[model samples]
Target chain A: MTELLKVTGLSRRFAGGGLFRKRKVFHAVSDVSFTLKRGQILGIVGESGCGKSTLARLVLRLIDASEGQVTFDGVDMASLPRRELRRLRQRMQLVFQDPYSAIDPRYSVRDALLEPFKVQGVKLGSPDEKVASLLDMVGLNTSLARSYPHQLSGGQKQRVGIARALALNPSLVVLDEPTASLDVSVQAQIVSLLERLRHELGLTYLFISHDLGLVRYFCDQVLVMYLGRVVEVMPSDAEPAHPYTRALLDSSFEPDPRQRRTITRLSGEVPSGYDLPAGCAFANRCPRVSDLCRGVLAPLSTLPNGQQVACHNPLIDAALPAACR
Target chain B: MLLTVDMLRIRFGAFSPVDQVTLGVDRGEILGVVGESGSGKSLTATAIMGLLPRIGGQVAGGSIRFDGTDLVDLPESQMRRLRGGRIALITQNPMTSLDPMMRIGPQIDQAARLHLGLGRSAARARSLDLMADLRIPDPASVYDLFPHQLSGGMKQRIVIAMALAGDPELLIADEPTTALDVTVQAQIVQILVDLVRQRGLGLILITHDMGVVAQACDRVAVMYCGRVVELARVDALFEHPRHPYTQALIRCIPRNGMARGTMTAIPGMVPTGMTQPPGCRFNPRCARVESRCRVDIPELLVGPSGNGVACHLAEAA
Candidate 1:
């Protein structure tokens, strides 16, 4: 499989320092690295303030990374010149979470779709026809093209959002909670539409969502993030190994009432990004936390099963850790 | 039953958002009010709290009986005694519900002091106790901090603490954990369940998340466009949903081991305002719509198992 995108040690820090105060650095994303094969969907799952959004911005070059690099299709994004990068942006696009605010309320659905082409300075054969096709591609009716975003329902507006992102025929779409704002039924429609588009267009996706259930079903692989760092990466079909990942999986209640599992509670709040602990950020809340876990920061290590985990005491196959054994 | 709502109609001028909704909650029971956005779930909660008038809404017709007393006919002054005292509400966004300018302790203290008639120090003591009950760590420090200093999940816990400060008999949680993380949501749900069991309080949890309903609620009321289309025990509803809308809703959720793109999304949008379909609001989106569904309104028919459904297809199922 060809590597479509490669991010190495990507990190973003926001320095909070007033003129009279001491400088404080906030690591929003820390040493994140990933490889995305062509035509693959990678889901990043995390809670609020987990830096998944920052990681997404860094991957797309929407925000400058303080450290590391992003390579897209064999081209280094950081090294690319402004003009070239702008042109290259045509191959990558972002679909925001809230479709209501993503597009210009003043613009009609057609104008929103065409705005991407205009921004990219791409001329099309019969732009009107292209707009109609874009709408149709996203499973939207052609009649909605002239309607303003306010006039459309949440689901319809999201369809417009998807259409706009695909206006330039982007190869990779970074979807940030695209269905979070829609109702479950509408979410199902959008999810299915995205799946159809992926197979039909051969498009790769980087899905970032808080809903683990949706992530597990929609994505091929899942990255569990905690306090700006990747805790674990596993196949969506497999059960997660890391304690944080397992806790996340356990926290999500399944829709089925007959098969209810007791929630595995994780005590303590997510640590502040401004001041990270010396060792594991999850140690405070991890049920399997030990003295060793509190002493050393666990690096992302490839397990025997090929899954990557950054926990000193991962519950793989529900096996006890070596220390306990 | 601790609270009974019969033919509750909430209207804004000529626009009736919620119409003829009937539901009940027993002591120590969690009745899940399930609905999509604009499905009148929140409106129903507000009406129960005597907050409809503040939002320019009024109960056009109905009987809201609480502890064998009619709440609808009570004056504002009398209802105010029960608003936060006995019937407490926990909204989705805690940051907005909480006063940003006030410290967490004082904000929570105000609820107990004003409603429960506790002294300042006693209210302070009760506030800390409530926070501790909600599993908030370092309650002392959190008590002094403002709403902005706390995370979304912590803020929601504080909101729950404030609601519990009054030791209310009936709790109305309106999407209480919607803004929080899934992990935190589970914790909150567990806490609410524990509270209901321990204190024997009736809880009305309004949310759009079907999973939360399955996990926390005893009885589920599935609302569509301002009406209760289906009502049943949580287990029975998920196992054998009678209404087409309920069936479609259950099918649409992305569950474990479920293949991608196989979810049957109900076609068309939910009807809003007075423009709902005459007979059945869900008929436009429902795939199993019969011609009779378009002409006559279906009554809430009860099955042998006490599962209530308002659909022509209910008997067929």
Candidate 2:
């Protein structure tokens, strides 16, 4: 499989304070790297303030990376000129976290969906036909095109957001917690719709969410992030390597009442971005932290089946082995 | 029984927010109420505490008998006295529940002083002790700090401490852990479980997560569309859920070790509050829906070992 998106050594920082006062720098994302193949769903799972959304924004070039290289189909995305980047934007679209805020309240669903085409200076002869088709693709009725966002339900609005994202027929779409605000049944419908769209349109996705179960279900590969760094990257079916990843997996709340809860509780608060500690960011909360882990930053090491983990003492023992070991 | 809700029905205008929902909580028992958003789980808790919003929802029918007193018919002044002194509620968003302008110690101490009738100095001392018990590091420092200065987890602990300050016999925790992170969620659950056990308080835990219910609740009541569809021992309900809605809800959750794209979700959306289906509200979404389910509302039929299910199929079976 060829890579559609490749990110290497991505770093983002924010500097603040007045002229007299000392400037403080916050490392929001640090040395993050990953590859998303064409038509593949890459899941980025992390808690709030972990820079998951920041990484997504960096990939979209919504915010310029402080230092890094982003290659989209072998083209340098970060270094591209504004005009070139604008053209590339049609190929790579982003679906925001909140549908209510993402779409303009002043515009109807048809206008919202057509905004992308209008921006690209590609005027469709029959705008209504294109809008209706996009609505149908996302399982919405053609009549919905006339409705405003406030008139529609949360699920219906999200469908409109998806239709708008697909207006340009982009090859890659970045969905940030698409179903977080939706009802359980509606969430299921949206997930199925995404799966169907992926199969039908051959769309590649970077699905970012805090939901572990949803990530494990929808993604082909999963990336565990903590404090702006990828702790572990593995195939969805493969056993997780890092303890943080394992803890995340274990802590996920299951719906089945029959299933016994096996949550491995991790203590300590998430360290502030303004004052991050040296070495491993997860060392403070890790249950099996050692002196070596506290002193040195762990590098990504490959295991069998192409899984990679970033930890001095990776949780190899916790990983369920071959034939349920 | 510490608390008993019998055929309770809450209405807002012509709409029924909670329809004839009946359940009981014994002394020292954790009764978990599991359902999705707008399922009336929160409304049921509010009704129990006599804190239902005045404008819309009102106790139109039935009774809430807590310790042999009908709380629904109680005077406002009496209910206000019972609100924190005998029965306390910890809502989902602790940030909104706690006063932002006040320091943690003063807010917590206020509850102790008003409910427990303790002096100012004694209440302050008790508040600090409660904060320490909740594992808030540097209790003295945290006491002086405002609510905004603390983390989400710490703010939640302060709320829990305030709820416990009154030493209430019954604690209604409505989605207490939904706003918390997973790691912090586990810790909060542990604290609540330990507290309930130590004090022998009846706990009514209302949440959307079934996992939380399974871990903490001894008995479980599954609510849907403002009604208790099933009630049973935790183990029994998990082993064999009688109601179709209960089964569907369990199936909807994405489980670990399941293959990608293999999750089974219940079809159709939760019906809006203004217009619910006539017969069984879940009939439209249920896979096992029969003709009888669409026309007649099923009564709570007793099953094996006191387990109860409100379903036409279960009644026939």
Q: How well is candidate 2 docked (DockQ)?
A: 0.58
In candidate 1 chain A, where is summed lDDT lowest over 10 consecutive residues?
A316-325
Task: Score chain A of each prediction against the true chain A by TM-score and list the results.
Answer: 0.96, 0.96
Query: Candidates' lDDT values, in order?
Result: 0.89, 0.86
Query: Candidate 2 DockQ category?
Result: medium
CA shift at A246, candidate 1, in angstroms?
0.6
Residue range with the least summed lDDT across 10 consecutive positions in model 1 chain B? B298-307
Residues A1-325 of candidate 1: C-alpha lDDT, one tens digit per residue? 9999999999999998788999999989999999999999999999988999899989999999999999999999999999999999999999988865866678888788888888888888898899888888987889888898768888888888888888888999999989988889899889988999999999999999999999988998999899999999888877688988888888888998876777766877777888899899999999989998888999999876678899888877643335543
Error of model 1, residue A61, in angstroms = 1.2
How does model 1 score by TM-score? 0.96
Off by over 4 Å in 1: A100-102, A318-325, B302-306
Any residue pairs clashing in model 2, and if so which? Answer: none
